[model samples]
Structures are given as C-alpha cells and as structure tokens.
Target: MKSKLPLFFFLILSMFFSACSVNSHIMFKTKKNEVIVDNIPISPADAYRLAPDDKIAFTVFVENGKRIIDISSGVNENSAGNQQINKTDNIQYLVRNDGQVELPLLGLVKVGGLSIIEVQEKLSQLYSANYIDPFVQVKVTNRRVIVFPGTGGDAKVIPINNNNTTLMEAIALAGGITERGKANIIKVMRQTTEGRKVYQIDLSTINGLKYADMIVQSNDYIYVEPSRQLTREILKETTPIISLISSAIVIISVILTLN
Candidate 1:
C-alpha cells in the first residue's frame, strides 16, 4: 500500500496539470503569430451616428433659440410660462427599429444612420413649415459602452456624453486599465455595417498615440488583455488539492501505525 502511494500521487499531479490552465482567467486571447486587424481608420470627424432603439432627448426652439436664452436668463414673467412648457417637452424619444422617431410636429422621421447634427438639421427642415427659424437639438441619452479593464469584476458600462469620446477617454472613465492589464493588447470590438469588427490597439508606446484618439461608438466593447501570473495562478489552483492530499496522507499513516 505504501509503495502504491507514489503512483497515486503522480496520477493526481498529472490530472491537476492537465486539467487546469494557469492563465484560464485571461480572456479574448489570440493565437501566437495571429493576424490581428488594426488598420481601421478613425478620426474626430467620425461622429457617432444614431442607431435603432436609441433614446434621444429632442427639443426645438423658435427664433433661433431666442426663447431658450430668455427661459435660461429669466428675462421676464413669460420665462416662467416658457419654463413650464419646456419641462413638458423635455422627454426622451425612442428611435424605432425602422430608424424612425416620432416627434411633436413630425409624426415619424427617419433619424437612424444620421449623426446628432444631421438629425437636428433634418428635424429643423421638417419643422420649418410650421415654425420660424426653428432650431433643433438632439441628444442621445443612452449612449454607452462596455469596458473590461483587464481585472476580474472591474468591468464597467461607461456612458458616452460627449460626441467625440475617444478610446483613451473611455478607458479613463473606467478607471484606466488595471496594473495586471497589458497596455499593448487593447481590443476594440465595434459593430459595423459589414459585421462585427475587432480592432487591436497598442498604447504602450508613443507611436500608439494615434489610436488613443480613436473615437468610440455606442455599444462598443473595449477589452484589455491581462498579464498572466503563472506561479501565483498555479499555486492558487493547486493549494486546495495539495491540502486534501496532505490530510489524506496523515490519516493513512495513522491507520497503518494502528494496524
């Protein structure tokens, strides 16, 4: 029985090494010498276009925002009345699946695939028939992105309030990458007209500054690959098994001595 113990321990160790991977917690892994797509062109001019199911805060002003300034400055007693009306109008409008949003004057206008500026212009044109010098404002109230900053339980859904929020800005909003994260292995997964496009970004050097300014769109996923700690991970995975084996060995020794 004592001679068989060596074989038993060897079998257990073999199973442990085969079953557990030291870097199992790491995600979005790439193969060695794998071709990563990183040539996606990006610039500040590339604004975030409105998509279906997006909620927007739509507002229209007359006399080129004269009423807006009056209401803001409290110019007269009429400001109170305007303020009341503004409160009633300050509500979110949903863009339907067919890329149309129902507005006050315009029943169902196509706003999807258009930038916020474009939507405002389109709405202003449609409302021009009814109002004088109509000024339109459209804001996507639910624009956000998911970011995994290379640490477990450290992911965040960051809201994009700015029109040109960059990749670096989004990371900053998510508290930047954790110490265990690899700066050179950042991935940006974006949904394009063709399909889902994955872009690899390397921000570890000065040359990577260009990608730092890459504007992020709504619902994009940013993942930072984590550095693998082989020794620590192996110990963590094997501690319980080793403890159990040690306990069993003590029990077996006591039984053999009693015998």
Candidate 2:
C-alpha cells in the first residue's frame, strides 16, 4: 500500500500554512478599518459628583480680620485667616450609602451628587452657621479608573493622580493593550446624571487625537475589544498540539508495522 506518512505530513503542512495565511489576511482586513478612523468630538467632562465609598478631605479656615499672607502665626490678627483645624490635620471622611458624610461638628451632612467645589461651599455655609466665617476647600483623595485589556486578562484599577488622565495614558498604565486588542474599538463608560454613557475611541489615526484627549473620570470603565481574528488565532494555537498527536500516532503505526 502507498505510504500514508507523506500524505499525513502534507496535510499537516497545508493546514498550518493555510491557517497562517488566513490569520494574516484577517489582520490586514480588520486593520484597514482602523486606519480610516474619523475624528470624534467629545464634550468637556462634567464636574465629578460625590459617590459612596469616596474619601474626601477638607480644610476649614476662619477669617480673623487678618491681612497678612502667612496664616500660621498662632492665629494672630495680622494673619490672613486662622486655621480652624491643624494645618497638617485632615479628616478623611468617607461618604456613606445614605449620601451623607460625618463631620467633626457638622454631624451627618448630605454630600452625594455634589461636586468638590459644591461640597466646599456647602461646608462653608454649614460652618458659617456656627462660626464667624468658614473657608472650606474639599478634594477627593482616592480617584481611580478601571481598565479591561481584553484577551482574557483580568481587569485593572488604575489610580488617577492628576484627574486629567487621558485615554492613551490609561491604556499605557494597563500594559498598553494586548496584541489581540482592537484599539480603534475601545469603549469608555461613564456614569452621569442622565444615566450611564459609553464613548468609543479610535487610536489608529491622527483624527483619533481628540477622542484620546477625553479626560478619564473616577469609576469609568475603559474596555479594549478583542480583534475579530481572535478565534482564528486561538484555533491556530491548537494546531501544534494536533500536529504532535498526529506525529505520535504515525510513529506508533510504523513501529507496529515493523514488528
């Protein structure tokens, strides 16, 4: 009988080469759309509102009719303003589920749906009710954005130090997206007063620069969708195992024939 070894080897080689060629074609076809990315105009980010589990710190100042630049001179009359709390002292207040934050003397104050500036104003008004004048400056301590790089990778929570973190910076921090990740189809999900919003970004063309400039917000989800060729690549990865199994079977058959 004609040897089956040659035919078996030929089939394996052909399948491998065919898979490689198809994968290459898919890569080119999918990337062609990416290069044609059009500019997407995005509006400015709305003021970030307070949410549960957010840590906020505020510094309260009580004006003492001072006119000096330095306000740390033992609360003197010449000082700009007296520090209600210690300069180094800061209360890391956590927003509760009830949309309220406990303060030293203000008790449970509703802070949900309020921006940092709004909270500062509200606290100033609250403290003014008791004291002469309360100057409050509030800021969020922990701000972060979540990133999902796709390709079966785990999600990553990246901290936003500047609050103005761009799309590219966020992806870079998450290890710059996987090879199977389609950058042009990236999605940024945000929670707004109207409801949840999703923004699509394309990074392959210069026109995508505007979208990339969109500032990242806390609790935002950045997802990089995997390429359509993912299935082909996965199937290609299994080819080696199939080839090994077939080679082993061929060797065993030859040994039996010789015996």
Candidate 3:
C-alpha cells in the first residue's frame, strides 16, 4: 500500500495536468505566426458610418434653427415643421436592414452607410422642399461595444456616446485593465462587411500609441489577455484532488485503527 501511494498520486497529477487547460479564461487567442492587422485609420476623415439596426434620435428646425435658439420663441408660420419636430424629437428611429428609416412625409429614407453629419445634410436637403433652410440634428442613441478588461467577471458593455471613441477610451470606461492583464496582447474584434476582422493592439510601448487611438465601433469586442500565473492556477486546479486524497487518507487510517 505504501508503494502504491506514490504511483496513485503520480497518476492523479498526470491526469489533472492533462485534462485541465492552464489560463483557460484567456480568450481571442491568435496563432504565434499569424499576421495581425495594423492600426486602422481613425480620424475625422474616417468617422464612424451609420449601420443597419442603429437607433437614432432625429430633430429638424427651420430657418437654420432660429426658433430653437430664439430666447422669445415666436410662432412659426409652418405648422408642418413643428409637427415634424414633434414626430422625431426624443423618439428613437431604427435603421432598417435595407438601410432605410421611416420618417414623416419623407417615408423610408436611406441612412445606413452615412455619417451623422452626412445624414443631417441629406435630411436637410430632402426637407428643404417643406421648410426654409432646414437644420437637422441626428444622434445615434444605441452605439455600444463589449470590453473584457483582462480578468474574469470584469467584462463590461460600454456605450459609445462620443462618435469618435477610441480603444483606450473604451478600456478606461471599463475601469482599465486589471493587474493581471497583458497590455501587449490586446485584441479588438470588429464586424466588417466581409466578415469578422481581428486586430491585435500593443499598448506596452510608446510606439503602440497609434494603435491605442484606433476608433471603436458599435458591437466591437475588446479583449485584454490576462497574464498566466502558472503556480496559482495549478494549485487551484489541484485543490479538489488534494481534498479527495486527504479524505481518503483519513478513511484508511480510521479503518486500520478500528482493525
């Protein structure tokens, strides 16, 4: 029995190492030789374009928003303008799968693929037929991204209130990366027209500052890889086995004593 004890413990240890994966919680792994995409251009020139299913709050005013800023608001001659404002203000309008949104009088207007400013210009031109020098304000109300800040139970769904929210901004909003996070192995997964595109960002050096400013889009996933603590993880995985072995030893000793 004494000789068999060493062999039994060896077999259990082997099984534990073989069956359990270390750093299993680490996600968005890439091949060691796989080429990762570089920093995407994120500037005013490459602003986020509207996409399907994006909810927007739209508002329009005549005379270049004269009434909106007017301290003593005068009654407008065009009751239709007031009606249109009432129909859209503070109400969410969904962009359909076909890239169109249902608007008053305008019917279904194509808004997908256009930026907020572009949409505003397009709507202003369309509403020009009814209102004089129409001013349009468009805001995307439901732009958000998911962030995993390098630790379990630290993932957050962050809203993209700013149209030009950067990767670093999103991380900061999620309370920054945990102490166990690997800043050099951050991954940003974005859904593109072709398919899902994964981009690796290294923020450990000043040279990586360019990638840090990469603008985040709606539904984007930012995963910060957590550093592997081999000793701690191995101990955690072996705790149950240790407890079982201890219980078995106690039982064996009790049976022998009774005999």
lDDT (0 to 1) per candidate: 0.79, 0.71, 0.79
The residue pairs that clash in candidate 3, if any, are: none
- Between candidates 1 and 3, which one is better according to TM-score? 1
**RMSD values, in order shown:** 4.4, 7.0, 4.7
**TM-score of each predicted structure versus truth:** 0.79, 0.67, 0.78
Which portions of model 2 show Cα errors greater than 4 Å?
Answer: 1-45, 64-90, 150-155, 230-259
* Tens-digit lDDT string for candidate 3 (1-259): 8977895887577657834777887777788544265545554334567888899887667798764311113345343456545545567889999999987767899998888899999989998987779888889999999999989799999999887799999999999999999999888877766567677878999988888888888888999999989878877777777777779889998999999
Task: Give one digit per residue, the lDDT tens place, for model 1 in 1-25.
Answer: 9998895887578557935788887
Alpha-carbon shift of residue 109 in model 3 (angstroms) = 2.9
Candidate 2 C-alpha lDDT tens digits along 116-135: 88998898798787556767
Which candidate do you rate higher for TM-score, 1 or 2? 1
Measured on C-alpha atoms, candidate 2 has an lDDT of: 0.71
Clash tally for model 1: 0
What local lDDT score does residue 81 receive in model 1, on the 0 to 100 scale? 63
Please report, as a residue range, the 10-residue window in candidate 1 with the lowest summed lDDT: 69-78
